[model samples]
Target: EEALRGLKMAMKADSPAKDTAAIVIEPVLGEGGFYAAPASFLKEIRKICDENGILMIADEVQSGFGRTGKMFAVEHSGVEPDIMTMAKSMADGMPISAIVGTDTVMDSSGPNSLGGTYTGSPTACAAALAVFDVFKEEDILGKSQRLGDKLRKRFDQWQEQFPHVDNVRNLGPMAAIELVTDKTSKEPRADFAAAVTKKAKENGLILLSCGMYGNTIRFLMPVTIEDNILEEGLAIVEQALKEIG
Candidate 1:
């Protein structure tokens, strides 16, 4: 509710309402920590966009294609966006992106109206099609959900064991752990997060840190990772935490 109020206030403070065109949001914030927006907040945003005659664009580049145990993160909110942009896992690193929109909005432009220098490359399309085939054949969504459960369990254990490990969260396999000075104060411990990532890297695990205060260690492991490999990587993270915590 506070977030919605802030949005409304910002929109009102934008001066001319006619200048507003669309409200773009990431259903699950990627680079700004792995926080998933509440479903109610998303629904409210949809209503606001409809009432204000503004298009709602969902940026699903990081949270799309079964990353969140769903086809798209917005699907969890049951909110249909006016426009959606997807990439990253779409082609499994084939360097392709796509934009989808409602028929009314899409048809507003003439055929062949949208084109980029490398738009609609045949190779990239083939890679994307292959990816879809693999998704159906391998039950990727189910694997993602199971992976998320495993990650959440591990994070919970870490939170209980380590004093600095706080605010462990995830939207399916997109998980993160925030390092703080203490549980009561909740002061961000950017140094701890950096040290852990550096130690993890030295121990043969690639870990990334994100968030506004750079105290968040986000996990972006592949859904198809083998059980042994996943455990090995997680063990490395635990070792790093023990050494740095």
Candidate 2:
């Protein structure tokens, strides 16, 4: 409610409201920590967009293509967005991006109105097609869900065992843990996070840190990773935590 109120105030700050073109949001925050927005909040945003004649654009670059146990993170909210931008895993790192929009919005522009030098390279298109085929044949969504369950279980154990590991969270396999000076005060421990990532790298595991204070360690392992390989990677992370904690 507070967020929505703030959004409403921001919208009203501009005259006539239509001055605001669109509200773009990431259904699951990617680099800003792996926090999934509440479904209710998304629904409210949809409602506000409808009432205000503003388009709701969902940036699903990180949370799409089975990363979040669903094809798109916004599916969790059941709120249809006016436009969606996707990439990253779409072509399995083929460097292609796409924008999908409602028919009305898409048709608002004419042919050749939007064109870039490398708009649709045949190689990238083929790669994207192959990726879609793989998803169809491999039941990748199911694998993603199972991977998320495994990751959550491990994260829960870490939270219980480590004092600084606080606010363990995930949206499907898109998981993260926040390092804090202490759980009681929740002071961000950026140094601890950096140390853990550095240690994990030294141990042959590439880990990433994000969040406003750079105190969050995010996990973005491949959804198709073998169980044994996943376990091995996780062991490295745990070892890093122990050494740094």
Candidate 3:
């Protein structure tokens, strides 16, 4: 809250900071190591935005569409923003994105002031609609919760056994393990994470790295993956880690 107030102060008269427009953030950081913004932080942001006239934008590019076992990650914090941006999983693999906002905010712009050549491309729109159908029929949100539970359990165990696994964080099924050189230093070991990802791929389990130092193993597996397949992939990861050791 203090940090937020300080930021607001920076935008005051004669301040070096330019006049503020809006604050955009990912409810659950994606490439930033699957870090989920704390509920308190999100609520504080909303409060600050409301106190001022600043618009709050939730960028749900990777955390929307049941990825975090919710329709949108902001739902977890129960903080609704003035605007929400969604993409990536919205249309599955299709090229599409959406900007949803209150009618008043949306209508503030003149018709000629806001238009995209592919704003409503039929193919992308159709794909997004299909994704909604799948979500409804398959109960994607429920699946995400189940998958998250399963993965979290294993991650907890891994953290206990591997001293290198500095942190295990997740929002529903969007999970990640941060690597460190040692518990005391907690220094990110990017090389170790990169090697683990490469080794996992060699063992038939693909993994990705992220975070400031690229020392985090982030998981983006589909929530609908078969149980056996999920288990097998995890096994491969375990094997790869053991081999790397």
Candidate 4:
């Protein structure tokens, strides 16, 4: 995203900050919006960070591990992050988080510095590993790609049919639609967004809404969801949108 790119440039410009630089970002800006940053932007930022000795940090809490058609969203760009943070769905809601980094960066931190009381406790790790196995065995990553594609097509259909829908986008299972009264002005229609989300929940689609302006509906389908179930959820959304429109 431009935020990371701009931060990198700002660091280079600031003599003091330049020496202490760490570029943190979400490859797929989730709550800010369910939009995936262009891969080209990611590549440029990676090159800039490398040349400037800055570390690129990807917040994959919302876009990692079978969520973005890749094991990790970083695979979309093929540019490795110096440090990647994760965990929202690592183990069936068994709260966990991690900071994966290069050996050098990891070694920089001392021993016994980051583990939690539950960190790496056998049960969680074993369960997470089992989830990983299921993901691979069931081709969950491929399903994510198809799910995103289906979501985009459905979103586009809504956008074309409904004038109030300003934009529709998909990033793996993270798809969203924005409502606007003035398409040219792109003024957020928060009322419409909230009302539809409420209706969708009533109609059986447990959607979430969180954007800078609170005018977007976000969907995060479980990667392991069956096609019939996924379609059922989307159908609920479509019905809700129809009623709201």
Q: What's the lDDT for all of these models?
A: 0.93, 0.92, 0.86, 0.81
Residue-wise lDDT of candidate 3 within 119-236, one digit each (tens)?
Answer: 7689999999999999999999999999999989999988887778868988889999888887789999999898899988877787899988999999879989999999999998
Q: Which lDDT tens digits does candidate 1 get at residues 40-125?
A: 99999999888888999999999999999998999999999999999989999888998899998898989889776547599998
lDDT of 4: 0.81
Question: Which tens-of-lDDT digit does each residue in 126-240 have in candidate 2?
Answer: 8999999999899999999999999999999999999899999998899999999989999999999999999989989999899999999999899999989999999999998
lDDT, candidate 2, residue 69? Answer: 95
Lowest summed lDDT across 10 adjacent residues in model 2 is found at 112-121
Query: Lowest summed-lDDT stretch of 10 residues in model 4?
Result: 8-17
Q: List the residue pairs that clash in candidate 4.
A: none
lDDT of 4 by residue, 80-191 (tens): 9999988867765666667799998899888778776568578777777887888878888888888888888888998888777877887777788898875688899898
TM-score rank order: 1, 2, 3, 4
Candidate 4 off by > 4 Å? 1-9, 12-16
Superior candidate under TM-score, 1 versus 3: 1
